[model samples]
Target: MSILAALTPAPTTNETEWSVGDLAAALRRTLEDAFGHVRLRGEISGYRGQHGSGHAYFSLKDGTARIDAVVWKGTFNRLRQKPKEGLEVVATGRITTFAGKSSYQIVIESLEPAGIGAWMALLEERKRVLAAEGLFAPEAKRPIPYLPGVVGIVTSPTGAVIRDILHRLEDRFPRHVLVWPVRVQGEGAAEEVAAAIRGFNALTPGGPIPRPDLLIVARGGGSIEDLWAFNEEVVVRAAFAGTIPLISAVGHETDTTLIDHVSDRRAPTPTGAAEMAVPVRTDLMAQVDDLARRQGGAILRKLERERTDLRALLRAMPDADAFLAAKRQRLDLAEARLRPALAGNAGAYRARFGQVIERLSRHPPALALARARARLAAIDHRPRTAMVHGLARRADAVAALGRLLGSLGYRAVLARGYALVRDEDGLPLRGVAGLAPGQRLRVEFADGTATVRTEDGGPLAGTEPAPRTPRRAPRRAAKPADPAGAGTGEAAGEAAAGDPARGRRAAKAEGAPEDTPAARQGSLF
Candidate 1:
């Protein structure tokens, strides 16, 4: 019923019936030997991890038949398309048995998408993931070197791709190309291509082998499967991360890869990449020659124009000697006329100056000023003398007026033994008729005042009684004063009768000398 049993000699009669463990062990060996390193194409299902054991457990199913598969972590990690449920893929591994469970399973060493559709789906998913990371943005793209001294290329060394690039570079501008041989397709191709790109980048500048200024990851045109290595995330990221400018020439112009989008530039073919790296030698030479000729022609034209301008300037300029001679002649003629004209002007000026001097001498301001000075000096003392005399006279008159005022003052009358009497209201009593017997009174002397009580007998002992004079009757109409001295006597008698103080003043004035005509005139003034 089994390969092990069929291969044995009927298990030999002496052989005891195999134990369950032994049978399982024998069966595992038989299964492994018969189906070792088999390839299976199926849709993945029930995929699970090896649970930290660095392995994966899954079931590969095609309709009814299904097989359990296990891929070790090492193999699983290396797989370009990792195992996922519902994905159709081709799994290549050895068939092995799990004795504990008594089950047969394929130990997958490698895995790939089963068809173009699966591959495309995986490719699109990868593209989206990397695109979200901004890896494929136009701004991320670097500019390819216009001319590289050394060009690094990553592709299959045996393929026509490498030859084509080399030949293209030779046809254009020959360059030192470093070829990093790598598998462009098949298993492990992605890793090789990615590693090659990184290896080229890791090279030290100015080393034994000069670091490439530009890089080219190229492969001949092929189907998507044949070209899928270039689309790998590892390859695309390597190209994107490389410092050197990279040009990706993968497959035909119509066939696109992830590297094409990530690389600095994309070429339709490997030859195109070579062309992008360097320009044609002959074309560059021709350009340099053309530029040199153009520059020379420009210089010659400029020099010729400058020469013609110099000649025109020379023609326009007058002869220096003739110009100087004409100026000299004008100077001589001006000088010849200037002598006599200056003499005539000087003589005329002298005559006019003499006339001005004569007129000035006739009405000399200095002489007039001297006369005015003498007159001012003569009058200056007169006004000063007059001011002094007038001041002295004014002072004398002020002193006389002060003495007169003092004699007329009330204090002067009090000093002459006269006392002023006032009632309680501070008013001088003109008569004793208004006084009451007990009313208070104040008597003012020249020095001070005393308070006293009014009585029928007048004030107290310290006070003096007021003179009792009968009240005067109303005066009859009196004759106007006569102009002569005769009427003065009658007027004086009448005044004395009315007011004794006025009569005393008039008698004192009359006792003085009569004024003469000159004295009267002086007093009038």
Candidate 2:
């Protein structure tokens, strides 16, 4: 008996039994009394997010036990930490039974991690995941430029971190700065910070807005819970994928985050990032001035040394007339040899030019042009001849395929001599599977078809078979053979080619199977 029936009172002349709903209600109240308020700690399981009704449903499970759990819309909204699979949480709520499902559930009013240690375990697991992906690798870091033209800062506009970075930059070599205002903490803060990083990278270099040469993601010091947005996977991944170099100064010198590991450089403070971005302006100017003075002094000393060397060489120089006498003698000697050399070169060049003219005459341009024309005329007719031959070959292939299709046709088999069996519905029957005693069947022979009835037990079994005579009681006929004008070869083929309805009617009248087209197809199958 069902539990309801067991709980219900038996009917009497003046008594009544409990309804199903009333019995279920009683059980629900009994459950509440036994477990009205309780606290459970277990790892969450099967959490696929919230239902449309804003209710969250999942199960709390331990090594060998599992119980259904739910957080109502109001309770879920007020929860400090949302439920997630594999997270061990402490649930404070009341136990209740739902009649609709005939199951028990814990209606959670509050949910949180089991303890501070659980939060650390979760954070460590997330860190390992990010590190395994190579996002925190040393090779992933890019060098920060010594002097950036523009700096893009990602932080809250109203925060002290931004103010510190700006003030520090002004004291050093001041440069262009672009600020991307974003929430440093709270809901969706991680996503906004990531978008800011990507936005800085996406700027067209020479467009209306200049892309940042360096990026700084800074935030004032905060507790671990407040700094969680910087440690989020999205923030870490954005910093890793960004083309611009970045310095992460999320918290104080002692605080660390995932973004710090992935960023190009990690600064101890916001001011420290600014100092790393540029050099001191006054120091740089003084260094440049000193190098300029050294360069000028070296040039003056080289000019004075050259002037002194020229004066010493003048003291050892020869007389002007003596110097010119040898040059005049050399000029007179060169003029005498010049005319003979020019005449000899003229004769050699004339002979070479004559040889070239003779070669040109041997192979004239006109003869070459005539041979090319002849070859061109020979090639022009080949295409038309080839096309005619190709068409003839294709036509032959088509005719051969047509012959192949005809030889393989089923009609060719029917014209040879087989028969087929069909049911009353004109559907082919391979066996006696659905047949019963007194069932009508169609027997199609090569020439025509006939109607017959199953007898005895069925078509395939009986002590004696039905006689080959009409089912009609008023008349009897002889056993059938091939009818007149119908037999094995051409006669049967002609009979089958005639009206099919006429053959079916004749078969019905004689009550015998006839040869038809399909039957003559000698069992090709």
Off by over 4 Å in 1: 1-34, 96-102, 319-325, 328-525
- Supply the global lDDT for candidate 2: 0.78
Q: How would you encode candidate 1's per-residue C-alpha lDDT over 1-525 as one tens digit per residue? A: 698778887444665798999899899888988888988999999976555888788899998899898887778777877888899999898998898787888888888898899999998999999999999999988877778989999988897899999998999999998999998889889999999999999999999988999999988888888888888888888888889999999998899999999999989988888888899999999999999999999999999999999999998999999779989999999999999999999999999999999998998989999999999988987998999999987776566445435544556555645577777888766555556788887877778988888656334557664433433323323444332332244444444565766444333233322222222212211
TM-score of each: 0.57, 0.46
Candidate 2 lDDT by residue in tens digits, 156-193: 99968888999989999889999999998776788899
lDDT score for candidate 1 against the true structure: 0.80
List clashing residue pairs in candidate 1: 54-73
Q: Which runs in model 2 stand beyond 4 Å of their true positions?
A: 1-116, 304-525
Span of ten consecutive residues with least summed lDDT in model 1? 516-525
